[model samples]
Target: MKKILLNLVHPDINQSVVNKRLLDGIKDLENITINNLYQKYPDFKIDAKVEQKLLEENDIILFQFPMYWFSSPALLKEWFDVVLEAGFAYGGSYKLADKSFAVAVSCGGSKEAFSETGKEKKIVEEFLYPFEITANYVKMNYRKPYITYDAEAGLSEETLNLYVKEYVKYIKEL
Candidate 1:
């Protein structure tokens, strides 16, 4: 079985209806390490060694976060800066090479809202290109991202539960 490291990067997961539920749905799964970044580094002081160790240990690195300003949250970006350093993730042995990298991002707007016909005038994939670039640079296999749309639009209980299951399934398949 592949050991998956799920890096949960919500700034305030407790108050998040979508992300919190998704986290709860898969927290008990075996062979998966759920590292809550915000909870671990509330002061924004990241331990690069510890983070790199986690990357070294897992077969898959999955980033789960809400799309903020068409990009990842601040801590996730900080993680990219500190953890993916030389001699570890790139420019040397490339520790992350051949490992699978993927993202599970929740969007605040509807799917249509991200299209040219809608408000944003661009697709969701356009916003997620940076992740692909990073994965390519590290030589990791970039998998298709799993996205939850209309997250801030207040999904119904049934819809939320469905998405939670889908998120779990996506992780398992990864």
Candidate 2:
């Protein structure tokens, strides 16, 4: 099986229902390295070299987080700025080419909110264009994102359980 790198980056996990449950479900899985970014770098000071090393060691990279204001938290953005440096992740002497990247995210709004008939009236894919562009820049295969909607409203126990199972399946398949 291919090694998978699961990068969990939630700024406020204590208040996150969907993400916390998802993490709890897969915390003990094998052949998967779960890097809790906030826990590892509470001071907001990331180790670029170590992060780069981790990126190089894994075959599939998963960025797991709750969608905040249509994007990721500040630290995750910082991680990209610092770790995915020039001549490494993109630009001259790029190294991330041919790698795989995917996003596992949860949104507070329902799926309808991301469609023409809903509030935002725009697809989530359109909102996540930047991530797709980044993956393209690094020449990585950007897989379809795995999303859980209306997370704040709370899901049925059965539905939540299914979400966890599907999440694991998504990561494994990638």
Candidate 3:
């Protein structure tokens, strides 16, 4: 079985529906670590060594978060700065090479809003290039992100359940 570090980075997961359910749906899965960043480091003091060690031990690194201002939550970026250092994630003797990297991001707008005829005038993939670049930089395999559009007001209980199942499947397959 593949070991996944499902790093969650939501400002307030209690107020979240999609991200929280997504996390809960996978609790019983074997070899999956649910690392809630905000809960762990509310004061923004990241333990780089421990985070790096988690990365080293996992077969896949899955970033789960709500898209914030076209990027990840602050702590995820902060975690990146602190943990993905030389001789570990990149630079000489990098360690993340060949592992699978993926993201499950929730967007506030509907799918149409990101379409060419929609408000943003761009696809969801456009906002995820940074993750792709980071994955590529570390020589890890980058997969297409699993996006949940209109996350705040979107989906019924049935739809959310389906999405959660899909998310679980996505991680297991990776």
Candidate 4:
């Protein structure tokens, strides 16, 4: 099994419903390393070298977080900005190629809201284009994202439980 680097980012996970549950379900799984960014870097100071080292050690990198607005939380973007700098992730002599890069995001809105007739009226993938592009640019294999709709105040207990199982299964498969 490939070593999975589960990079989790939640500004306030104590209040998260689905995301927290997802974490609880998979926290003990084998061959998986969980990195909770907010807990590690409360001051938003990302250690680029350490992060790069983690990236180097892991085969499948999973960026798990709740969708903020239409993109990831601020620190996640910051992680990219700092850790994926020249000579390590991209540009000269650097290509994090062949690595599996994917997102496991929680969306408070329902699936319909990402459809043509809904509120955003744009597919969820559209919002995730940046991640895909980044993966491609680094020559990594970008997998389809994992999403849980209505994650905030909507998903029922049964549905949340099902999603937790699904999430664990998905990560294990990867």
Candidate 5:
């Protein structure tokens, strides 16, 4: 199995419902390293060398977070800026080349709300284009994103349970 680096980038995961449940379901699985960014870097001071080392060790990099205003949380952006600097992830070496990069995002709105006819008037995939392009630029295989809609609004117990199972299965497959 490919080793997975699960980067959980929620700003306040302790208070999260959907993201918390998803993490709980997959936390104990083998070959999966869970790195909670907010917990690790509370002051937002990320260790680029350590993060680059983790990237080198893992075959698959999966970013798990709740959607914040159609994009990832602030730290994740900062992580990219600091860790994926010149001579490492790009510019020449391309350390992350050929690795698999994917996202598992929890959205506050419903699926319809992210569509053309919906309130947002744009598809969720459109908003996720930057990730795909980033993966391509770094020469990583960009997989289709996994999304859980209506995450903030909430889901029934049974539905949440099902999503947890599905999330675990997805990670295991990767």
Candidate 6:
């Protein structure tokens, strides 16, 4: 079976209600490697070589995080900056080329709040453009994001369960 890497990059998981539940639902499945970035790099010191090795091994990569200030947590950004080196993830060499990348994110606000027709003044797709651009640069297939909205309010067990099922389905398809 092909390997899928799920990088959980939540900074404050202790305070996280949504992401914690989602991750708990799938932490034990076979063929999936869940790398909790914050726990691994507590001092923000990411091992570039190790990250590169993980990327090389996995056929599909999922960046799972809680949306903070419309972006990834500080540590994930640092990981990208340090690990996605020139002549590796990008440039001509393109180590991640032909691999699949997807973002599974939880937003504190409601779905309506992330729309031009609503308060936040941008679509969820627009908010996720940075990830898409990065995936494009690395020549990876940028799958549509799996987003859970109103995350701060906490999800009902039914809703969380549904999302977890969908998440597993999404990974299987990739």
User: For each candidate, what is the lDDT?
Assistant: 0.94, 0.88, 0.90, 0.92, 0.93, 0.89
Report model 5's TM-score to 2 decimal places.
0.97
lDDT at 174 for candidate 3? 81
TM-score of each: 0.97, 0.95, 0.96, 0.97, 0.97, 0.95
Q: Write the per-residue lDDT of candidate 3 for residues 1-174, one digit (tens) a residue.
A: 879988999999998999988888988899999899999999999999999999999988999999999889999989989999888888896799999999999999999998989999988899999999989998999988989887868579998999899988887788
| Model 2 worst lDDT window (10 residues) | 90-99
List, residue by residue over 21-105, the lDDT tens digit for candidate 1: 9999999999999999999999989999999999999999999999999999999999999999988888877998999999999
Q: Which candidate has the top score in lDDT?
A: 1
For model 6, residues 118-140, the per-residue Cα lDDT tens digits are: 88899777888999999999899
- Among residues 3 or more apart in sequence or in different chains, the pairs in candidate 1 whose N, CA or C atoms overlap within 3 Å are none
Pick the winner on lDDT between candidates 1 and 5. Answer: 1
Model 5 residue runs over 4 Å out of place are: none
**C-alpha lDDT of residue 80 in model 6:** 92
| Each candidate structure's count of clashing pairs | 0, 0, 0, 0, 0, 0
Stretches of candidate 6 off by over 4 Å are none
Worst 10 residues of 1 by lDDT: 86-95
lDDT of 1: 0.94
Question: Candidates 1 and 2: which is better by lDDT?
Answer: 1
lDDT of 1 at 52: 94
Q: Tell me the lDDT of model 5 at 21.
A: 95
